[model samples]
Target: MLTEDFIGRVVIVLVVTVLTTFGAIHLFVTFQQETSASSLAVVTRTGTIAFMVLQLVMTVWRLPPKGTARGIESRVTSVAGTFLILVAAFLIPAVDSETVQVTALCLIFVGTVSSFFCLYWLGRSFSIMATARKLVTSGPYSIVRHPLYVCEAIFVSGVIISHFSALMVALGVLQFLLQYRRAKNEEAILRQTFPEYHAYERTTPMLIPSLSSLDWR
Candidate 1:
């Protein structure tokens, strides 16, 4: 059922997962010199639960119909999004010490707001399983073709900036690249899916929305 691209990406995902996991373990152990492993484990479990719940909700609502597989780029973006969410959720709280207190809180607040907005805007349009859904070219889509992805980047950026670690930084940059690639492919598909999408694309920026672009009518 899986295409070569998907298979290839799955391999990449596995490798990245292992590396990130190792990095996370090392990070914990290194910092465990200062903090308690039990507390960190609690943080990791809590983050995993929260992220999994959010992912479940998104998946149920936004999954595309059967046979509508998005390309490698989109899938990669999805994977990156998942990775960053777990990384931020699990590690950020653990690393939140006196030196990074303000940074961590600010990042969490901003990222949470942005991610919520993304989820709200995506509504029933957020699916990994792939299913048929109406091309959402209004509301947030009217402002930007891919508001959800923009929100995703914003979320990752907030978390990375808050933590300011090598691993988070690497993940954030990779996520941004993947999201951009995915957005491009998604826009191409959108152009075909919606009768009015070309017109919508002409008026709307991809992500950096401006007030003047809105019709407000």
Candidate 2:
């Protein structure tokens, strides 16, 4: 017997699946016709679509039971984080920055590709709200507590460089700040739930990965 709450979650999840799939197809089709598109545009569009695909997978299969949220801050910051992850790339002006180079394009691709590993490691632990699921301590998490956010910083920076816009610039900055706050709110919950979180926090920098602390192997 499916409860109303469970049915609601399923319905919302299905809706998200439809939206992300449609969004990915739309972006790809739009970009496919751009035979004259620059390398930066090509990479940015591809990166955005790849990100959407990964997010769809996470939401559909890999998510854990969402824990109790802290407060309004948790939900608000979660929305902000989602906006950055899903919508910000599309918000970037389709026009090329005219300043992009092959090197920059390469960096963008690298950031986009590298982020998948962290997402894979995160697995079912991913959540939009400040809720505890599993405390991932290996892979990129060993370096920075919020590896996904760090990766997004790199990936989004690359996208912004490829397609510059004043409004996107402001949104990017705001997203970065909100990501930090969102991560903090999550850490707060983790600290309360798990005893080991204090030591983890002490050793792991919140967002920026310290070279000295990172395991090189």
Candidate 3:
């Protein structure tokens, strides 16, 4: 008989796989229709699609948690932090400025590429919730303990900038708080599971990279 964890993993993987497939198809169709799209737009859309696919693949193959957060609060915060900013992006009307659009695209592209590398470093250790699979402390992780969140802030900043509304700003602030909380929750789990996590925490900055401790390897 399949355990609850196995069933949950299957459901999560299936949901992500379906969402990725549809999202990729929609992006492809939009690209095809926009015959005169800018080069930046092309690159951004392609990178976004690639990121989605890669994320789906990673979710399907991600490691089982060594320990998970005990309560519903951690799960809710994790989900909201991961997805609420996206709601603002889709709901708010973007500014009608070519310069702003270009800047937004550049930020999005850079964030996407950087996030791809972070995900690569994370590999199977990635989790949507506050679960400790493995402690990764290399690559971008060496720069900051929560490099993925930093990349996400970059991406979401672009979105919020493009849609410069009061509501978007509010949502962005809320998302940031949720992400911070989620990071803390993850740290708690990691600290509980791994003895070395305390040393790593002491050495690494939470979100921002320290210029002194920049380690690429």
Candidate 4:
């Protein structure tokens, strides 16, 4: 399981790096452009509905987890992230009306596509339990170890950007931090579970386009 654990840790690192880069870019843009607080309520509501649907599906489907900390932290992050998003959706006013609309569209598209890709990759091996029964190293795992979690970060960030709430943006950053911590713990457990994880780590491209790049191969 070394291959799997190593691959998982590598993917987590990549995801965190990408998020940091994106966060920097987003902050720069938001600072330059004035945001609206009026549309926050509407966007937040729609986002909440979408998030709720996803949560319900995950709950009903129930996937295995890596460890207790990973499992518990996942739920906490979800709830906290949801609450922040909801606040932006319901209470914050839209700062830039036109931009807000565009932002929402972009967020929805990116989040949906990323999330669907993760779910498809996870397939039947997906579970929400606190411990994993098997190492998933095919499909998305073959490409990036933790596609679902990576995409989740994307989704959360997208929603925050869609709402254009400064407070929510900060909270989203905190959410990511929490997620990274959880991933760190999960990776340690995965390392203990799998012996082949290191070999896989050397080959996979983490959260980037590993399989996609291989299409030409």
Q: Find the candidate with the highest lDDT and give its number.
A: 3
Q: How far in Å is the alpha carbon of 151 misplaced in model 1?
A: 2.3
What's the lDDT of the predicted structure labeled candidate 1?
Answer: 0.56
Q: In candidate 2, what are the lDDT values of residues 21-110, reduced to their tens digit? A: 665665666566544445446656666667656765665664454354546777778766655634655544565444563444665677
Q: Give the distance in Å from residue 56's predicted Cα in candidate 3 to where it truly belongs.
A: 2.1
- Residue 65 C-alpha lDDT in model 3: 83
Ranking by lDDT: 3, 2, 1, 4
- State the lDDT of candidate 4 residue by residue for 1-217, as single tens digits: 4543344435434533444444444444444554454344344345445544554454445444444434456545534543444344444443456666666656666776677776765554444323454566776566666677677776676666656666877777877776565555555566667777666667765556654535421
TM-score of 4: 0.61
Candidate 2 has a TM-score of 0.80
> Candidate 1 versus the native: TM-score?
0.66
> Cα deviation of 154 in candidate 3 (Å)?
0.5
lDDT of 1 by residue, 1-217 (tens): 8864345445544645564565556446645564454344334333334434565555544544423445555666655655654555455444445445344444445555666676776777665422235666666667777766665555555455545677777767776776676666666666666667788778888888788667522
Query: Whose lDDT is higher: candidate 1's or candidate 3's?
Result: 3
Q: Once superposed on the true structure, which residue ranges of model 4 sit more than 4 Å away at CA?
A: 1-44, 63-96, 124-130, 208-217
Q: Could you tell me every candidate's TM-score relative to the true structure?
A: 0.66, 0.80, 0.83, 0.61
**What is the Cα-based lDDT of residue 110 in candidate 2?**
74
In model 2, the runs with Cα more than 4 Å from the true position are 1-22, 25-29, 32-35, 38-40, 97-104
Which model, 2 or 4, shows the larger lDDT?
2
Error of 4 at 189 (Å): 2.2
Best by TM-score: 3
TM-score of candidate 3 versus the correct structure, residues matched by position = 0.83
